[model samples]
Target: MAADITPLIHRVRRWPRRVVITIAVVAVTLLAVRIALPYVVRNQVNHRLQSIPGYTGHVADIGIALWRGAYALEGVEIYKVSGEVRTPFVRARTIDFSVAWRDLFHGKIVSDILVEEGQLTFVAGATEAESQTDVDRRWQEVIEDLFPLEITHLEVNHGLLRYQDTTKTPAVDLFVTNLRLAATGLRNRPSESGEEFPAEIVLEGDSLGGGQLRLAISAEPLAAQPHFHLSAKLENVNLPELNESLKAYANVDVSRGKMELAAEMAGKDGGFQGYVKPFFEEVDFNNVSDENKSVLTRIWENVVQGLAWLVKNKARDQVGTRIPFQGRFGDPQVGLWTTIVNLFRHGFVRAFNPTIEGTVDPDNVLPTGDSADGEGVASEKPETPPKVATDDVKKVEPEAAAPTDQPSKKRTP
Candidate 1:
């Protein structure tokens, strides 16, 4: 009986060795795939990018290798050879990324990207000869045919943004810290036939001039296109500093103050439209000079004169007294004639007589025409009518008729 049990035990031991060998083979195969996949993918991606039309100076770094999967190229840089270069997306130098294991098997590539410290520069007024339409068209083609990757997680530790008017300089800089974004369901479709996907993004930043920003954006997939909504709030920002940023872009300057803003936007046909109203506290205007004031005064005077009669009548009826209205002062040449007209019309000053009060009427009270004596009355008077004759005496006894209080006594004498 003992001898029979020993043979059985040996056979059972052999089964374990067979199981180990199978596992070893599978492990080797997986390891080889993990090492080889990144190089293969990098080469394919680079080759495809180089083949695209009008694409030059675009490069991708070597892919990272790992046990589970490969952590691929740190970043990809694309630039134009002749025109101004603008980078839409940039990866931070401190970022590390990992490839997805399932993506390799399913033929869908995915990346887990992390950003440590980064900065993005935006230049305004730097227009390229190529229209945005051309760029967009090329981008669509690139996404549809060349590159297809789903980004699972995008983590940013610290990021900075600097904006400048390319036509002007001394760019305004903005900084954001501890930024993070996660994305899913990224797919590409042709512009002619549209497809939609879901996405959500959140951001936080501390602006250079002294403010904080909190932002959130979301979108839902639709049949034809995806619709997006965004909400953002900025707190405790100095407006003068912000205005300096806008000086190169617009003609207005903002004085010292604080401001707040909030808004939402939706996307359509590869573009977006939205409305935003900013609220300011204690803002003042800059660049208001005497010359500018004069121009403004002329404008105001023109506007006021149009409604002057109405305003004057209303004021007289309500207050029973004349109100003094004047225009702003600046260059007097432009508005001199209008000012004189208004002054004479409103009896603001007496042009004819130095000592006369402005209240005196220019037509009647002043010495002019028949009223030269300044009496304001006509000088002529009409004469009285002559006495009428009495009726002729029809008979010898007929006599003239006279009032009792008249010359009766005188006639008898």
Candidate 2:
């Protein structure tokens, strides 16, 4: 019985040894494939890139590497020649991408594109400008021709954005830092009828002091129309710094308070309608710069001064005097009058038009009264005659007749 059990144990042991050997062989094979995969994939990538009509230069230094079941890429550069391909839109910098071989083999491309370090530039009018209808048709064609592909992850670090207006000589530069983004279901083709891969983008920067901003966006792409709906919120922005960033614009400055905004937009073919609600606290117009002050002054003189004068006169009549009123120094057309009125109601002005009719305190610092120190002179109201009592009229009538009878003898002057 012991010998028979030994035979069964040997059979089981033999099966375990075969399993180990098979695993070892498979491991060696995987190792060899990993070592050779980079070269093969790199060559394939080079050939595919060169085949594009506009590809000019290509260089791949470090090959692909697979470690821990993930693919890694290094040392890749590509340059754009001239091309008629319209898929990615503009033909600028077509190279400078590194990706995992597995992603490419799986028909999905996942890579971190270093756009900030690359020299990517765009010439907007290089292609002929078309009418809105034509543009829409072209966009529809492009969307229909798009192929399905996946992008697991994407990141842009320390990116630089520069724009040159068609007439401007110098380009405006902006820097974006620590931009981390991730996405899923990013396909060139629409998933469902109007489905798109959901995406979340986060951006942060300290270029403006105490003016950091974070924005989040999510959108779904539409079929045929290639439309997208997006929502974004900007937080913790110092409006003063933002205004300074817009110094290139002629007469613009943030007067007072920071700003936070939230908005949503959806459409296609460069047409969209959106509402932005901006919240401001402790906002004032007197804090604006000189240039902006001039603009504000002109607007006030033309559009608001007449209204203000009327208010000042009415207030004087109610208070029986002219009170000291500080007029706002911002664009009156943009609800500055309402702000001033609110400030007046807040006791900043000595006299303001109150809902309750008739007379304000003359001693109020606003336009109602003259100052005790003679610093301000109050406007005087017209005098009104005193009213006589109706009953006292009869008492004076008899005295009037007696005076007439005596007057006949008293005329001996």
Candidate 3:
């Protein structure tokens, strides 16, 4: 037994060197992989981007996160090489693609995408060569190739949506800045409401004239036909700041005023219903100089000013009209007489409410029949619930705004 103890001591001494060598080899392998992963991803992404038909794209850098199973792309830019427009079509400061943990918990595998400081520009001109609308590009294919997982969540922060018209006298450049958007539940996951239309999207931005723009949509993205509920609102827009665009398009100019607009649209089974309500407060067109003005132009301006003055609500000092329509998607019919009557009704009767009227509900609309046959059935506001003084009845206010109908001022930092 004493002789065997000497052999055991030698074996124990050799074990430490073997373990050290094994650890050193693993450490070197992992270090090499960590350095190489980003290079491989960068090359693959750039190749996919350039494969799009009419666009050229490049990525400045790529970063990998092994623990989270995510990657980030920096300085991604896509340009239209075929168009006369010099500005890039799409540009992003950073884009992150990662696993959607919330959906994963629900037994669904999907991906989440976040884009920061992104810009999408559109150029309008007379010919096809002058316009850069991305109509000819297969950008969706590129996105599908880069990320193999199904996208369930998307977010954009501090974005810009820009439009440029070169055909006009003084090239029109309009943009919405500080834009934020979120789209979730694209794959129709289960929800508390258990509604058929589960996908929800929200968009908010600041327009060129200091207007706050907000839009919300609830949709069934995988439906056979388009089905959705949408509400949009733009408020406190200075009218004079948009004179160039107005004068170019409408042949009208406003010296002073602020405008607020609200609308609701619902589409289901190839049919739709909606109304657009516009409010103008303290608008004026009479301050124009008489020089270089034709007689017809002067008469037209005076007529426009008189009509607004005549129909404006005295209490609110706002002129507004609700133009309602409902019909098949292929051919829509506007309620011309209803629009004319609303003008008088808005001024003589109660003023049109400067808020979203939750009258358009896709579930309430008839999919087929007179309602969907372009018969011009007017959408009605929810009736006020009868008040019961007794304790047995609970009072419900139908006019109360829903959370989705209210314009949110939330901005991403």
The TM-scores, one per candidate, come to 0.48, 0.41, 0.79
Better of 2 and 3 by lDDT: 3
Clashes in predicted model 2: 6
Ranking by lDDT: 3, 1, 2
lDDT of 3 by residue, 1-413 (tens): 88979898787677888797888899999999899999999999998888788788999999898787799999989988777777888988889999988778899678999888778889998887788886532665688787778888888877788898988855677777777788877763444566677787877777867897877878887776678878788888888777767656756678788999887778888777778888889888865643676888678778888888899887877889889877777677788888878888889986777667665667655654125333333544552211111112221112222222112233111
lDDT accuracy of residue 214 in candidate 1:
62
The TM-score, computed over Cα atoms with residue i paired to residue i, of candidate 1 is: 0.48
Question: How far is each candidate from the true structure, as Cα RMSD in Å?
Answer: 35.6, 28.6, 8.6
Clashing pairs in 2: 322-367, 323-366, 323-367, 350-365, 350-366, 351-366
* Pairs of residues at least 3 apart in sequence or in different chains that clash in candidate 3: none
Report the number of the highest-TM-score candidate: 3
Q: Give the Cα lDDT of each candidate.
A: 0.43, 0.35, 0.75
lDDT of 3: 0.75
Error of 3 at 118 (Å): 1.7
User: Can you write out model 1's per-residue Cα lDDT over 1-413, one digit (the tens) per residue?
Assistant: 99979998787677878787888899999889867876776676667656655454233555555555545444554444444545433334444566766667777567665554544544444465321113545655564443245555555555554444545533443444333343444333222234232444666655644666666555443324434545455566666665545444443444455665543333433333332324444444443432343655445545544443332323222101111111112211122344345334433332211110112111222111122234421111121110110111111121133112111111100
lDDT value, candidate 1, whole model = 0.43
The TM-score that candidate 3 achieves is 0.79
